[model samples]
Target: MAENNDLASGDDILASYHLPSPKPLWLNAVYARHIVRGNFMALSARPPTVDMGEWVAHQVVEHWRMLVTFIRLVHDKDETGHTICNGRTCPKMSAGPNHSFTWLNSRLEPVEIPAYEYLSLVQRYISTKIDDAAVFPNDPTGVSFAPYPGASSSPSSPPNSGGGSGPDWVGRRSGFPQNFLDVCQKIFRQMFRVYAHLYWSHFEDPLYHLGLEKSVNSCFSHFILTATTLDLLGPADLEPMQALVDLWAANGTFPQDSRAYGYANLRAGERLLALAGATTAV
Candidate 1:
């Protein structure tokens, strides 16, 4: 877990942000328990190890889930073939030039690209990839599927590779090569910008007006907490929306005060940390 700065205590932090209390996602508690008992208990009971590759794959799938969910909330209108919405639609998040988020390029130099421009790139990327269901079939019995070979990072964002199946823990094992793991990391880093722009720039009007804030905030909180738990996001990557993350975290939506909150899954998956020599505690 990232340490709190000399900033303040939990109470002060929440007050400073003037955020509301977070509701427990307990309405469907029984539903979750049922799934775990039926599907996860046996597997979790056996081993908790997840290596770097599997970890990255897990992050990709989870982050993609959040990204797509939020994207669905957006209304796209384009007179041109391009569906890029400048700050006109989401003024809260519009960047100056082409309305792009500021990011450090591979050379570590700052670069900016419009949000709509990115949507085009990402949509193209997703549409071209072979869908996961087509590649990996569901099995009643657990089965291990190694990552597709020939997977490599694109020299640019919005990878050039036509991808493979979504991340899944094969039967009961976990591990991946460093290069493949890096690909997952890069994918997540870009996808996170998608979340940051939505939460920071356009959570009002349509998003909030449609009563989507609770769902969005809750989902974003989970993403933040999970990313932090796994050390998936560096401080620099998180800096853009760190303040909001801090606010939501303090409000109990994603409590950062306890190790328990830091790693909500540690109890069931301690062996993963053990294998990785990670010290993120429960």
Candidate 2:
């Protein structure tokens, strides 16, 4: 288990800038858990370990720090403004009003939940896959199925010299490595299918429910800034991820368009920073 820091204790971090702490520590934990679980599942090739609790705690801390930094930047601007409520009455506001209890707007208010909820959701998905292992079938036959004699052997061996005591090639060499190409093609297809399923099941559904086009666009901008801080992503990856976020944000696929989008972008920024820190230490 990880050490529990008072969520409210981070007020000092928020004080460094002119922004209010968005919510209590517990709510931050919930958001952190959801973002970490999604990221872990996307990146992990194998099942996660039992030490996930510790990982969750660490992720929550990192996420909180990222949130603080983001709030500071958004409020750091010196632009003041007024809104005409009834088209005749002006409500005065500065760029960084102390009365601003909400983040960006009322629609972007943070949620209150523990981080464990997200961990449970990820575990459930993994468990479902484990229970359905039979869906991923392999060949039962022991036959070599090599395209040519000794082709199934390691690459260290000479190619198709026919020195091995295996089945004879019927005069014509097997169709220009058809079996090798077939296996490669099959593996590629399986990988893509799995990626599509997981992406849709985890990310697409939530985005669709959230109506997040604008938020995602904002995330793209945040990604640029955060990526610079972390130094893990280059222009190639950043550009594409930004484009994807923009597409989704514009399409209104994020939940709670204002809040969800900002929060999600904040989480991504946190992950980038963490990655950079880890890389630097290495």
Candidate 3:
């Protein structure tokens, strides 16, 4: 039957696409920093030495990992539910052709992102900046690698570098000609804007129109919790939704009552901000 064939085709499409999986939520604590007092003389003026680049890369991948997880949670598999704004519904659209949205970056600084430009920019950013070691976006298992108009041919797909968490980076960086961590930070800054736009601009549509409150709230909580635990986000990055978070916590939407997360009774909201305050720099 045609319906059966279509079902099989759908399975094939899903099978060819690859997305990162969420880490066990409890594992976030393992990466949290703690204060350790030492002999004043022995401690020295400088703090402990660390691989700053690689460390930031880990944060980048983890944040992306959670972002992908949340996207999957809220996206309708049938493709009938996800709203295609196509620029008309965007607030910037009403201000004439030259309008732009003020997007927040990794440092919480506001930047001008032009209206209707994000989708293509994101596709280009992911295509060009993604780790050369991982599968290029056009590799059958990617998220529509060549998304921009007139784009043809995928980027060069490099062989696996092995041990990378999510095709962002993993083992061996000496071969790279650029400072890898700086690139990762750039990627994170842009990606954060994407997340902010989703929560800020489209939060209600998904909740009311799509009936995805449970999924949206849960996914966002995970995103906030993970970002907080990793020192990837600062106060300014989260301030816009502080009230929403409080409301969710008060209603028991976060630290979901599921044993799988290992923290059903955890007070996540306050702790999330606390961790950010402890780690984030001004």
Candidate 4:
């Protein structure tokens, strides 16, 4: 697969993250601009006129696109002229010894697959969702969004608002279908699995090997902050890489006052111990 033109090379990515002075090559112009300006909070904040679900939907699609581009670099050939990432190298879809993911087929039955295949399926699944007009409307201009049929009337869980009372004006916007939140949740969860696998299984090869670690870290940090800000991903979904998240948060990659930072501080020790135990058992 061809990489996105928006993505920069390893040297550029390194320069961007450790900048002596230049835009971060890790992100596209828009994202780089916000992070460079130190205004990711404002960028992550849902606009008053836009529904939270709608805003998240847009971001999820964008993040998926960019991440796919970034990850393709892993497939580049090594000095042996062999693919760096493939089913032979990663026979199971696992983040580590403790967390192995399975694909849900058309029948909704979980089926284990190789990491390479699982990631491919995810890319195709997200691509299909992005192309589905019913899932993500092409032009939602004049079309008013409605609550999904039989949606709960519980004020505790508003369809568009991901259940929170922010500044009086913030969470009240509405225009997205009630199901958008749930749909985006699934999308992001799958994407997070890909990140977990990358961090656990391929961090050394391709990423550190190509000097793309900082670049990938910067992108993942932005993704974590944005996804958590909108509540697209739950804590359980992030458990596999919670340790890395915590480290980034401690280093100020995420603002201390933000929801993302709070999430990063949540229970990572237990998960790490579990992983260690699993390894020891084997």
Q: What is the lDDT of residue 152 in candidate 1?
A: 23
My TM-score estimates for the predictions, one after another, are: 0.52, 0.19, 0.42, 0.68
| Root-mean-square deviation of every model | 12.4, 20.9, 20.2, 13.5
TM-score of 1: 0.52
lDDT of each: 0.43, 0.27, 0.38, 0.60
After TM-score superposition, what is the CA distance of residue 55 in candidate 1 from its true location, in Å? 4.7
lDDT score of residue 133 within candidate 4: 74
Instruction: Show pairs that collide, candidate 3.
Output: none
Q: Which numbered prediction scores highest in lDDT against the true structure?
A: 4
Off by over 4 Å in 1: 1-52, 78-84, 87-111, 125-177, 255-282
What local lDDT score does residue 251 receive in model 2, on the 0 to 100 scale? 27
Query: What stretches of model 3 exceed 4 Å from their correct place?
Result: 1-83, 91-115, 134-178, 248-282
**Candidate 1 per-residue C-alpha lDDT over 101-219 given as tens digits, one digit per residue, 9 for 90 to 100:** 55455798866555665655565554333134322223323333333433222111222222355533221222232244344455656666677666545565456666676666556
lDDT of 3 at 235: 46
Whole-model lDDT for model 3 versus the true structure? 0.38
Candidate 2 error regions (>4 Å): 1-158, 161-177, 200-277, 280-282
Question: Which of 1 and 3 is the better model by lDDT?
Answer: 1
> Which candidate order results from sorting by lDDT in descending order?
4, 1, 3, 2
Error of 2 at 149 (Å): 16
How well does candidate 2 score on lDDT at residue 30?
Answer: 20
The model with the greatest TM-score is 4
